[model samples]
Target: MGADNQFPVIQYVNEAGSLKQDEVKLHKEQLYQFYFMMVRARMMDKKCLNLQRQGRIGTYVQYEGQEAAQVGSALAVEDGDWMFPTYRDHAATMSFGHSLRNLFLYWKGRLEGSIPPEGRNIFPPAVPIASQLLHAAGAAWAEKKKNSDRVSIVYFGDGATSEGDFHEGLNFASVFHAPVVFFNQNNGYAISVPMEKQMKSKTIAQKGLAYDIPSLRIDGNDILAVYHETVKAVARARSGGGPTLIEAVTWRYGAHTTADDPSKYRDQQESEIRRKTTDPLLRVERLLKNQGWWKEEEKERMEAEITKEINQALKEAEKFKPADIDELFDHVFAEPVWPIEEQRKQHKRLSREGIQ
Candidate 1:
């Protein structure tokens, strides 16, 4: 048997926009909603890249190619479910009702961006890799103890599997029957290091076998597959079926972040090829066209609407004052530690004296 037989990639729609699974019914409204969110996310990612180039935001992470994986998995969860996203998962957070203005403010390095809207259990982006895995596990375990049906979904990259927290989180969740979905977007590259160089595992989904967590690998670019798989995982978690690990096989079409150069490490031509063949948005578009649900005028209207929404969010983000230097020290503890207090005082004195 080939790899396809060994590690099956769940997909409802083929590249030609034909339904591979006849049992799965395609809803026009649902398809339109998915397309809208994907387009919105793509637009936001492009705008942020431009903002970074113009020095309007700090180093920004782009999520252009992974929209279907992010948006589909996010939309699968319920309203009260907790979301632990990485810096590259603003697409997911935005789909889960995170504010666009707050996302922009995060790239601007403001602490306020970390705060989710009222009753939204979205954690700030975890920049330290797999650390959020443990947090997600703990939160899920807590909800389990509370006898609540809520589940936690934690997003991470392929590189995070190497971290100790990854194993610890899975082991704990398995032992305690925690309701958490470990969502891994295998985007082929961990920064400049390709997946082949990173690990010997044939598939990231197989990693969960050791912990006895139910796991599967799916075609991340197929929005229907992603959505269906995640819905099942969420349902399993809610029904006391314990943890799940989903490895969404996808690709990144750009540099790891705005600060990096992809040309140095990867063949740019490969990304171009993937863009033409495996783009997430294009797949949805093709499916829509195949189903006779696509309208050029509707797409144009969506673009205009999304552009206006993003521009308004950008304006709101820009209106915020520059972050105060001392505000960082104040949040470290309820009361500032002596060393931090001293450093804050010294920095303030230097600023007053106009000294470097």
Candidate 2:
């Protein structure tokens, strides 16, 4: 199916900045905040890619074109809410108050990087794909049981929806009325497998219908739409309306990760085209201009400040010594089982032999 036949793209502002002009109760300050977050995210993504190239950080996942979807939904959550992110959703984690230094450390292969600051419930990125959905559903169910209004939001890619755990999670959440939002970023492809090859369903949002959950397909590039719709979904979840599934239709301008090349599977020209029209930052800039709140000077200043901040975070992350090889084996259990101890000793012997 072509992009147009997917669904009526949910949007509040056009690229030209002429708002639908209804009483949506949007404020200029809110729009500016969204714009700043998107810009910061884009800057961080670019920095990480460069750091990877410099051999400073490990392999990186760049979320260049998915800023609005991440920032918009992340900003909708309150401080007490829990966030479950995949390796590609760092923008959401950052917007939800995850430390930039820790994020950099995470890419640097430090386990400590996964630890959230005091009272923050951000989980480490789940690289095993949709496995985090079960955890999110369980956490939200426990919160519901405790009568707390806190909601849990889980981020996954379109490819993740095909995992058995995804269906299981939505089923469990629907049955238990768990306060969780399953944020599926339909970025056209899962690694190299396009959505059509990954699933038979025409639309990801429609997947939630099996479980009787409320779901919507939104134009993920539209920051305003992403934010408002997420705010409503989260509000509904908090008000005992159970889980909501949001399929944010967006694209990734870069390869799935630094380790892959897009030219191998798809056309790079499409990404270049996306840069012109569907770029998330451009849409926000368009909105700002429509409202006469955008300034070129302000954009340049913001970019400069963000670059400095990213550099400072990188410095902090690099200051820490590389993770101890043994530390990886020590954390799994209170008392290392005999099998683990044997493996650890074997690992040490191999290291002494200069095997790696």
Candidate 3:
């Protein structure tokens, strides 16, 4: 059988929001918490897109349609766990307790934006493809050597799986039994490239099998499935079961970044249709209604509250003085290298000449 046939997409909730698995852990209060958290991340993502267009921030990476995959996996980890995120994975970082103000500041091009909350081990968003996987693997290996219970979770895309670091990270993790979760958000496209065009393997999960890691494929739009399966992966890693790879079969309904036009390469109608049929937020909303647990007033209140929270973070970010240009050169290395010193001097000279 083909890998796709062998690894069926798992889900605890259908796209219509109907519960498929009657697990005891899917209680009322916790489900509501998950709903609220996803909503917060979604709202923040949308607002950041608007902020980018308004020239209030720098280029942004939108994660509009894959909230369940990011949020569910984020919520599965415990405090002190490590998270290495790609530029598009802020939803995961935020759900894992990154500061909203810092997130805003990040897009505003301030170094402070990279700082995680006190005691939180969230890494700065990696703009480079597939590099953070090594960081995650190394950190997890470090924790294992210390005999600590902490595990690391790294987020990447379908395109990243093609990078050598992805394979190296997995191979190292598998061989050394690094306690990490390699979470792949298969959003159907690597920017303009589709999955079929980029990979010959029928499924991303099968890639993990090559490294001898336990792997699973799950519905990224289903929060229940994402949360439960991720919880299992985390538990296994924590218990010294090494690493697990999860390929979240999902989609991104927007541009790869604010700088790119997705419409140039793909049909927009598919996104429009998928928003109705497979939006992670909509699926959860359906589930809530199906359970008779949804209230229009509560949803409205949640939206209003989240909007206010986003606004407060925005205000705090805007209040900062423009970042010093030296911050860029200084942070590049512990001591100034010749090239950096030359660049810093050139920039300062340009500023004085009003050419900046």
lDDT of 3 by residue, 164-283 (tens): 999999999999999999999998899999889999999999998889999999999998899999999999999989999999999898999999999899899999999989988888
Query: Tens-digit lDDT track for model 2 on 1-356?
Result: 64346445677766665566385766888887888899999899998899899998889999999999999999999999999999999899989999999999999999878988888899889999799999999999999999999999999999999999999999999999999999999999988988899888888988887999988888898888888999999999999999999999998999999999999998999999989988888887887787678899988998899888988988988899998988989888998799889999999999999997
The residue pairs found clashing in candidate 2 are: none
Give the per-residue lDDT of model 1 (tens digit) for 1-356.
Answer: 54446678898887778899989999999999999999999999999999999989989999899999999999999899999999999999999999999999998989989999998999999999899999999999999999999999999999999889999999999999999999999998899998899998878988898999998999999999999999999999999999999999998888899889999989999989988888999998999999899999999999999999999999999999998777878888887689998988899999899985
Report the Cα lDDT for residue 15, model 1. Answer: 77
| Global Cα lDDT for candidate 1 | 0.93
lDDT of 1 at 284: 89
Winner on lDDT between 2 and 3 is 3
lDDT of each: 0.93, 0.90, 0.92
TM-score of candidate 3 to 2 decimals: 0.98
Off by over 4 Å in 3: none
CA RMSD of all predictions: 1.3, 1.9, 1.1
- Stretches of candidate 2 above 4 Å error? 1-7
- lDDT order, best first, reads 1, 3, 2
